[model samples]
Target: MNPSHPATASRHTATKTILFVVLAVALLVSVLVSAGTGQLGIPPQEVLGSLLHRVGIDWLPLPTHPTGDQTLWAIRFPRVAMAALVGAGLAVAGLIMQAIFGNPLAEPGVIGISSGAAVGAGLAIVFGLTVFGEWTTAVFAFVAGLAATLIVYAMSRAEGKTEVVTLVLTGIAVNAIAGAAIALLTFLGDTQSREQIVFWQLGSLAGSRWSQVLIVAPVIAIGLIVAYAVARKLDLLSLGERNARHLGVNVEALRIGMIFIVALLTGAAVAFAGIIAFVGLVIPHLMRMILGPAHLPLVTASALGGALLLTLADLGARTIVPMADMPIGMLTALVGGPFFFWLLRRTRKRAGGWG
Candidate 1:
């Protein structure tokens, strides 16, 4: 088939529309179902009712259980909200990185932003630091993550250009150092703190609260807004840096700005959600495969896809083991690990081996 055939165009369009509809519907259903699921098990009606009631709809019936309202407000809702936010943020960050770098595999974690965020958040947890009060962990994570990005940018620059290979290797080196730091902090921390660090590194949304939600929501929102605003530029950048520059794009400024946004989104997310990896790495590629490389659709579809994936993953984490809340990160890693290997092989094949 000719690549530019009208039938092919219409098929891709049809597929994108179907994917958008499916993802949106799935996300809505997942959120509602997850709200009703748990130890107490509220019905879906009550979940929808509670949502509408909060917005002043009194006709729908609420949960009958004595503690249902409290559980929904305090525990279930916050966890689900965090899962959606963190997943969407990471996926958008991943898409942004890939767009700016012009590499299908580019991701926040690939450049050590997640590891840096982990190190910063680990410091806050172990030391019980709260200088920024509720924002301490997030602030620290952003700073350190930005620092990590700077390190990669500096180390990988060769006469004003950064080679992908050098940037990735430098990021790996930074990640190793951060890992060692995390281990040292674990050793020095109290037993309680050590346990917190361990659980955090593994990633769980077990104890999320409204206050934390309030903190992370705006950070991700800001990144998403900026990312969408620059979507056209991202598309232009994909046509090669020199070409983008000739086409009136400030390639350097766009790269740096997008990198900063990635750090902000990734840092804020991992600050609260712990080290959830591969959502960033996987969602964008999957979206690209289905929706094509247009950054605008990629942004919207990737957000929905990431939110749906994480919400379902969180549901499985709690329900899969009887009376056990398996770490959410473990579940994502299960899916991502194999996908990563397959992606690596495909990427290498297309590039005719790594340069």
Candidate 2:
């Protein structure tokens, strides 16, 4: 018997709409608030005026100094925007990967896509491949991530069906191999290249620019829409492969499409921001805990929550010490690692009937 009834469906829909609105407002406030923060400590009114001035609000007085105005317009805005985009993209990618593989534990980091992107970025740094303008590293990173996902998909396929456990195991193996490849690349890199590679590995949004935001924003938007479009199908997919196929879903096609989109989003995020882990794993699971397993709500909640979490984390990264910017990745891992272990313990307890 289906657990979903008409009342439950209506309630779920209502909850989702409310969550979306709340998150939308929250995101707007976060953007404005985060923009005003940093070492310079621009006043909120000034931040608003500068932002409005940029968009043709001539009546409002602008920041008189070029340095302050440029700091807000050029430096802070792009970093916050990139952080939001990367967080949303990685979270959605994780949701898609989990749905496609039918494993709650599956994530871009777990399956090696982030590592692949890092390798791609490292290769570009080491070799100076600049055929594609400023996007040389990004393009290669996307390609490598896509390739890694496809290889894992192929390896996990057996007798024309995907085994979720096998897929996860395949990811572990691929991730290890990708890790080695990255290490090897680092070993062979020159000192200058090695420093660049180290920074990329550690992950920071401190130097993000408008150009990087422009490159990543569109792709992530497209990927998010595609993922949401299939949200209902992903809900059905949670039932079982046989059940999903019986319900008129194209299982194989769905899996492949999800892998592709997730790879694109994950690769683009890693390209611009480097490998930040557990946003995907932690946020989606938190959403699930609060809102249940409906994909529509889950995806939107994950996006908003992930964006908020990363923005806050980035803020901490910048302000945690005076004049010392810590790696954003380190901050995320510091929090996400313990959370993940707690989740594992909780799962084990529940499974053992001790919850």
Candidate 3:
């Protein structure tokens, strides 16, 4: 078989299509399972029925258990949906950041955006700020996240271009400042507020509400759409800047647009769920490894992979302790930390020394 033959290309395309279908099915299954796993133990069938009923598909039989519909609709479904949104958003944001920086290790949480949002959330919690009433924390978090990204970009830009090393270093400095701000807020807060700050930092979807989901979903959906529209440009960008420019990509504009989208997606995710880590870093990298570096498939695969990961992680968070909800962030960090170490070691070996 000729490796470059048209038949070989067709077969490869067929394989990728099948992989995408499998991943989509897995994500759907994860959602159903996650929605069914709370204290009441709603079966997947009942969960599906409840969802169908809510969407006006009244032909399907309703849940037999008296409280099943209410529990699924009012509680479990919202949490599961939010988890999917946050997971997808974070993963896609990570993919964009990595593309923009041309580094596999780039991630929102690692690059100070999550910390910046955390600082804003801390302020809202400690000071009892109610500028946006119930959404004060979310608004503050979103704005602060964008602010941090802008600061990083401005600091990193030089001679009409943004260097990858400069951006990474700026992220490190911004993260340190954001961390210090959060710590100071924690110190000044009352016991209740301090606890709230701590728990929020650790990240959980415990209080996931339909209202919050409503706000987060649209933002993430829009960001994902924008990302997909530019997927080809991102692929061109993976080539060096000069080559990309020669190919007619407006490199500076693409970077700025991607940065903005990353801010919007990452901010929305953090605002609702706090700082869940590793979904972004791990999912995209894994997807890239399996599907190759084509941004379109990589982005789609990363979204599904992230959604599946978080839904499963949330299930583990709820069920692992048998009655207590564990911190979702802790679980992701536990998984991601080792993976991160391995990634660093591999990259170092590949480069033959740290840059």
Best candidate per TM-score, number?
Answer: 1
Q: Weakest 10 consecutive residues, lDDT, candidate 1?
A: 159-168
Candidate 1 yields a Cα-based lDDT of: 0.88
Per-residue CA lDDT of candidate 3, range 1-355, in tens? 6767998678768877987899889888888888888778877777777778877887666778898888888898889999999999999999998898788878888778898988888899999999999879888888898889888878877775666567768888998998789889989999999988887689999989899999999998998899899999999988878899999999989988888899888888888798888788999999888778889988888888888889889999999998899999999999998998898788778877755
Which candidate achieves the best lDDT against the true structure?
A: 1
State the lDDT of candidate 2 residue by residue for 1-355, as single tens digits: 5677878888877877887788778777777778878777777667778888878887656665567788887899999999999999999998888788765667788777888888898899899899898989988898899899888878877786666557667878987888888888889999998887887678889899999999999988998899789999999998988999999999989988898898899889999888898888888887787788779878889989888888888888888897888899888889888886787577556567422
The whole-model C-alpha lDDT of candidate 3 against the native structure comes to 0.87
Off by over 4 Å in 1: 1-11, 157-162
TM-scores, each model vs. reference: 0.94, 0.89, 0.93
Give one digit per residue, the lDDT tens place, for model 1 in 195-304: 97887679899999999999899998998899889999999888888888999999889988988999999998888888888898899999998788889889999898
Candidate 3 lDDT score at position 312: 87
Clashes of each: 0, 0, 0
Q: Give residue 271's lDDT in candidate 3 (0 to 100).
A: 82
Arrange candidates by TM-score, highest first: which order? 1, 3, 2
Which is the winner by lDDT between candidate 1 and candidate 2? 1
